[model samples]
Target: MESPFWDMMGMLGIYAPLALGAIGSILGCSAGGQAACGAMLDVESGYGRLVGLSALPSSQTIYGIVVMLSLNRTIEIESAPGLFAIGSLCGVALLFSGWFQGKCCASAIHATKSKPEIFGLSAAPAAIVEGFAVFAFIFALILAGSLPAATGGV
Candidate 1:
């Protein structure tokens, strides 16, 4: 392959974590937002609460952005594969967590809309999903630190 292509690959490895995470966040937010909208339609009150609930899934994207910033540095061919492995794994983990969190949030929104008393309790599942995301973020940071600093060359 051309040298530039290889360079791009290396760059992709470093960027994948943030990109995938953002994708997951987008999906998660969409799911929750849709559910929130539906819930609001069913209830005359608590429109503000439902809208606030929809934002729960957006935190994953912010986490991803933080990871991306921390992982930022020159890309070297020698370390590219390692970066790719770590970033992609982290990205996948975050993605699933974020997506499921959204699903859980949607369920919570639905359940709480019916029983306002259970609103806090209903968020447990989503909180669990967020915990998993935090785990992924922490581990990714730890793993990323182990990778060699880029030599900034092919």
Candidate 2:
């Protein structure tokens, strides 16, 4: 029972993704709630597109989680430790991306609710949120791209 193995197990494993998922879900849900409420208030404005956009924030979070699982599928336990660190960092980015995206969506909805006259203006800020998601996705791809074949002999 070597301690290095245990230390590695604790540092660059499922814990990262689990934390990421939890953070993403909590923040994303809060943002979604705000967006949904705002959209609900603007029932007659035809800004229904915003309602759909509310879910966009969770895209990166979901993608991050999938990437983490996929990496586990592809990478063997014997691979370099650096891969794990990179993957963990990517997961963190994804979590933040989703949280912020949701925030933008919620703000957009709020804007629409307050002034149905400026739905277009509201969309601009929402795009910023999308930018973060894109950044997170690209980072995840970079981290996951270097993975080796699964050690479980998948």
Candidate 3:
């Protein structure tokens, strides 16, 4: 590829993940904070468990990075431009997935704290959030398959 194209993609490759990571961090932190706040609702309740569950949302951030790296390796030059856009979509999904998961976990934490007896109900939100991560990862995997074979040899 031309210098500019590679240059731009190279820059994007780095910046895109960075941005997603930053967003995930912020959202995760917020989710933790919200969970903490929720715990306060019932200090005598599952304060520890609620906090731990709330923190679960932050896990997606690391997963996002892993997905990005995997996509980078999976996508070859043959696919080129098509893969680029799809990869970007996955990256974008990472950012939003973190946010959604965080929110859900936070809400779940709150619910748990308020109704410790119904922890299962509280866990539902986290499950919902997981759907987004699954979708993003599955799409990435599909897109990787669609990528054109690498040109020449490795």
**Which candidate number would show the highest lDDT if scored against the true structure?**
1
The count of residue-pair clashes in candidate 3 stands at: 0
Per-model lDDT: 0.80, 0.63, 0.63
For model 3, how big is the CA root-mean-square deviation? 3.3
* lDDT per residue as tens, model 1, 18-104: 888888888888888999999988998988877787778777777787777666777766666777777777888878887888888
Candidate 1 overall Cα lDDT vs. reference? 0.80
- How many clashes show up per model? 0, 1, 0
User: What TM-scores do the predictions have?
Assistant: 0.90, 0.70, 0.76
lDDT of 2 by residue, 4-118 (tens): 6734653565346546755775787578676676678657656556667676665665666665665554334445354567567766776776687677777777777768778
What's the residue-level lDDT of 154 in candidate 2?
A: 30
Candidate 3 deviant stretches above 4 angstroms: 10-22, 73-78, 151-154
Name the TM-score of candidate 1.
0.90
Measured by TM-score, the strongest candidate is 1
Candidate 1 residue-wise lDDT at 108: 90
For model 3, residues 16-42, the per-residue Cα lDDT tens digits are 643675586578658767767757765
Q: Rank the candidates by TM-score, best first.
A: 1, 3, 2
Q: After superposition, how far is residue 116 of candidate 1 from its true place, in Å?
A: 0.3
Worst 10 residues of 1 by lDDT: 1-10
